[model samples]
Target: MQIKHAGCYRVAVVMVLGMLACHTNTRPPVPGWPEHFGFGKTATARQIDSLNISIAPDGKGLPAGSGNAVAGKAIYLAKCAACHGETGAEPTPNRLVATLHDTARTKTIGNYWPYATTVFDYIRRAMPFNAPGSLTDEEVYSLTAFLLYRNEIISDTLQLNAVNLPLIEMPARKYYVNDDRHGGNEVK
Candidate 1:
């Protein structure tokens, strides 16, 4: 095509090149390409179950286990006492023990956590700082019981299980407001 100006001709050529560059490649995969690296074996069902530990506020994902403050104390002493201290009264940022009655205190699991199931979820996901995601479901439930007992939220005799754990309402739950906002063109 004839162009009146050299600059216009240059612009037309650049636009054509840009459109070509933007075209998507629809070629198939090269033959004999490696699909599997064959480095690690496939994960077993049991292995996937072990890592799929997640507890909801309604205790939907809680595993089959039961624990009380009495049993939890022993487990806590062995695994958590090193960092949280025997009574969880350690001055670290991870302090787990604190009562709502204590007027002057830091935000603790007892007073700050909005859901009882959260205690179990956090312990199962990340605890025993040296080894994260290493504790079993039973041990995690036990630790949750111990912390709740120490904070005066639950009695030492109260057994924590999938059913009862969610029923136990947290003191801080009242302070939290749920976000009921809808998405997709709705005003936030």
Candidate 2:
């Protein structure tokens, strides 16, 4: 049959061909392979537990330990001073402590992070730069306390535990807004 709209007919033909191409399975599964293609072994409960060390802002996953700035200072000096400096105010890119009054400088944990628990979480997850997860729970807690104390958020003697860590209000918390938006077309 003679085509009237050649462009429209060509587009429709391409669409149908594309749909058929998608539906047809060009490659069959390997004979001995399982449903998962036998790529990786299933993770054990212990394996999963080891990796599930993420701490929430509300101090949900904080391990059983407590520390103060006094203890934290020693840990920081030994582990963190090389990168974050002795006072955590060196000219490093990611400064842990900020003057708070200096608005011109980059955002430090004291002036940027919304929650105090985040300090503990980050320190626990990735810190010391050289050895990410080398610090123990007590050491991590102490480091967190030290950072908070250096940032002027907490006193030198104030002990930080899971319960009190979440309660300590961050200075920048008021500036940040919670992202309550659900899945939608909105870019923000």
Candidate 3:
């Protein structure tokens, strides 16, 4: 009986130690690698398209629809006022539009952004910080129009969308010049 009890204790101890050893030796796999990456094979074009929503300055990935400054004001009040402020003039956690009176003092969309498309692309990609990409294409257009109008860049009734969005000229557009990096040795 003593011998049996001792054997049972030894078996339990071995099992516990084995488990500990196995746990110590194992590690979680690194993410983003192919086989260790997704559930199965590579994603299809349609699947890729569903996720790839980034738009370019040349109107590359822009979706259809239009939005006006007046319509955008409502959307802004509903979705953006929490973070961007009521008039888009108030500085919340994030800077929305710049004040015309203090262009030298404040950095805003009107004072800093080089292109109108940049605003569209940025809002499309990141805005309503809490819930990114939540706004529809038309909402984004409206929001852009509203902000631009607040900044005095565009009229309140001006329509904004993929086609005309790129055409809207920004005040700070002239301030930007191409970065002429001659070589790695020194920047000219």
- Best-fitting candidate, measured by TM-score? 2
| Local lDDT at 173 for model 1 | 84
lDDT (0 to 1) per candidate: 0.80, 0.81, 0.76
Clashing pairs in 2: none
Give the Å error, residue 133, model 3: 1.8
User: Can you tell me which runs of candidate 1 are displaced by over 4 Å?
Assistant: 1-51, 178-188
* Lowest summed lDDT window (length 10), candidate 3: 1-10
Give candidate 2's error at residue 172 in angstroms: 0.7
Please give, for residues 128-166, the per-residue lDDT of candidate 2 as tens digits. 678898989889889889888888989999878877898
Model 1 RMSD vs true structure: 19.8
| lDDT for each residue of candidate 1 in 1-188, tens digit (9 for 90 to 100) | 11134336446876898798788654665789665558998887468655766667877667777888999999999998888877886767768887677763779977788899999988888787899989887888888998999988999998888779999988888888889797887886
Q: lDDT by residue for model 3 over 60-172, one digit each (tens)?
A: 56677789899999999998888777876775546677754564455788777767777777877887788987888889889889888888889998888677777777777
Model 2's alpha-carbon lDDT is: 0.81
Question: Model 2: runs farther than 4 Å from truth?
Answer: 1-47, 178-188
TM-score, structure 1 vs. true: 0.67
